[model samples]
Target: MKYLILGAGPAGLTFANMLLSSGEDDFLVIEKENSAGGLCRSCMVDGSPFDIGGGHFLDVRDPDVTKFVFGFLHEDEWDRYERDSRIDLYGDIIGSPIEANIWQLPDKKQERFLHHIAEAGCNRGEPMPEKFTDWIEWKLGLAIAEDYMLPYNRKMFGEDLDSLGTYWLEKLPNVSYEETKRSCAEHRPYGTQPGHAKFFYPHSYGYGEAFIRMASALGDRIHYNEPVFSIDYDNRIVNGKYSADKIIVTIPWTGVREHIGLPGKLTDSIGKLRYSSVVIEYVPENMDTKAHWIYYPDPKLSYHRILVRHNFCPGSKGYWTETNLTRFDEDKAAEEGRTYFVNEYAYPLNTIGKQELMKELLEYTASKNIYGLGRWGEWQHYNSDVVIRRAMELSIN
Candidate 1:
């Protein structure tokens, strides 16, 4: 084959699809699982489709992304939704980007939230902090940070917030104090919308359906149930069997480092990469809320968030919970008798030196005609749209 792509997830598949669309057909894809979609795959829980890899919806922020994805599955295959995401603040149901919906809170709480936002360093023109923990207080103020972001992040990340870097946090909602106050008075979203403010989902199937269709279109090019057992990166060889002139790896670099010979320290940094895991537990009981998802920041809660699956999954019922795989929750593991999916590699952490470390690793691999792509490959917490966009962009080049 001319090119060998590893891990048939969104990244690998998109790259291959782009190649075919451009009339280049000498590439091959190898997947570790029998099915495609990787983390985008869904499982059937009592008939309702559950995304075992956690909540994934396509963000149409980029028209090109919409065009590429819709190419595989028709536009009619999706149901568009204005994001009905909420925050569970104490016992209150606050609309997401809490600052924009504080008006829904009691008068006292509203006044207190405004006070906090008004005094936030960002509102006062102070420099943003570098550490994720410190940045929260600086951007949203101590009150909001303490009340929600900090505790919620602490639970989701299950790590010292100081260790995470701020390079990737631009994904957070960028609400200004003026827009926030206007939103409170106007009772609607205002200012820079958070990602997925309006998004699309599969009409009848889980989000994975689109990817599965894309994989099917590729036919025998996708080698399912066959994984990259080993690689000789220097020689552009996979499993000591398939050889290609160029390779794109979408798998986690942590595992790839071992098979490929690299300077020991670079390999060490790849191994030392930190990540967060998620346990997606599907509950058959439906939640009595219109929200597609709700963020629960309370450390007391067993799960950080709950997906109101029935609301978004067409005819599906029941909800699923996303819990960080921290030791705290492992000991708990929901006393209820529902089997759960444990994804050992979930969100890749952008901690401290991770960006620089991955850069060096990718640069060295490129020299050997090997490339890394997707979430684990880039070691960034990229959503599906971004992942697909990057893969397509890479393919066209």
Candidate 2:
């Protein structure tokens, strides 16, 4: 069957790659931007490469996904490194997988924190938590929920804890009391951390270079700068020009439903989905940070995380920091002598009832032979690896 893919990002590219491997050639990839990569796209400032969308790292735990991604780049084209990630909390640099390193806090505070966790462990039979706030307290106890989880998430999400869903917890690691005590006693933290403990980065070009290479493999299949303003679902035509028997959309879900003229019920469900925009600040490469990225849990700071890009690859020539904000003042950043790039829809919100709504939307679209793909397209918070794997799974099924 003829196929139309709405984006050339990771998900779209992965799906297209799968089709090519299967000898399915009747397909086209339509990208709105002048290039590929979607949110993972790259840009340059002052001759320094910066991932303006935020820091993109390869730390996926899935072996198949790893092999697939690495197939696009040569061995010499990339380098591997252990994660030098830390958190800047209360002006102290704590090893990341924060829960595992909580012992680094002051002795008095650590005792109190462990006491709360002990209490929480004693009450393990409590009912399941429905909201994000309750889930944090239930999982990590009141102390961690108050000191770290609540405020940090509030800043990142730009919303109250109660308004969000607990599914985003998948991105976080869960540490137990025994794990923490052992880590503390041994003076070595993060023994049980999942992915990101070790990762890889490209030796040349921007983070989007991998996706660009994948697009290059397809040769003339991708049509860049083709902004799809409207999609006629009834006739299965995009912008009144391209027609296909099946359409796979990797674009953000917000505009697609309206463009296709879906009914009010589905539109209402689409409207409830929320997103967080990001502002990436460019700084000197020599910034005083040995860590690849540092998380700021303090509410006083405007930015939640600062990524030291140079640390990831010493030849990159600069650093980029990311923060979620409703509004980013360019003048203020300029006044502070900083250059920045704003990326709208940098993160997907897992607000209450979001899972159900996304399921309903996917089902309705699938019935019409239209599939949603990727982080934004699926309206879920998925990492790059998961996005590619999902695309491959969809192509096969």
**What Cα-based lDDT does every candidate model obtain?**
0.85, 0.80
lDDT of model 2 at residue 380? 77
For 1-397, candidate 2 gives per-residue lDDT tens digits of: 3999999989999999999999999999999888888877777776756786888887757878888888897656777878878878777678886777877887777777777776663246677578778888888888888878787887788856688877767555544677767766676765576567777778766678888889999999999999777776666788879999999988887755345656668778878888889998887757787888888878888788888877876566567777775546777888998888788778888888888998998888788788889897798778788899999899999
Stretches of candidate 2 off by over 4 Å are: 121-124, 170-175, 334-337
Off by over 4 Å in 1: 170-189, 327-336
Report lDDT (Cα) of residue 251, candidate 2.
84
> In model 1, where is the ten-residue run with the lowest total lDDT?
327-336
Query: Residue-wise lDDT of candidate 1 within 1-397, one digit each (tens)?
Result: 8999998889999999999999989999998888999899986778878898999899978999999999988899899999999999988998887767777887788777778788888889898888898888888877789989899988888858899888777666654677767767777766555789999988888888888988988999989888676878778888888899999989887665346677788878877799888899887887889998999988889689998999998888888899887733554555655668888888887789988899998999899988889998888888989999999889877
List TM-scores for all candidates, in order. 0.93, 0.92
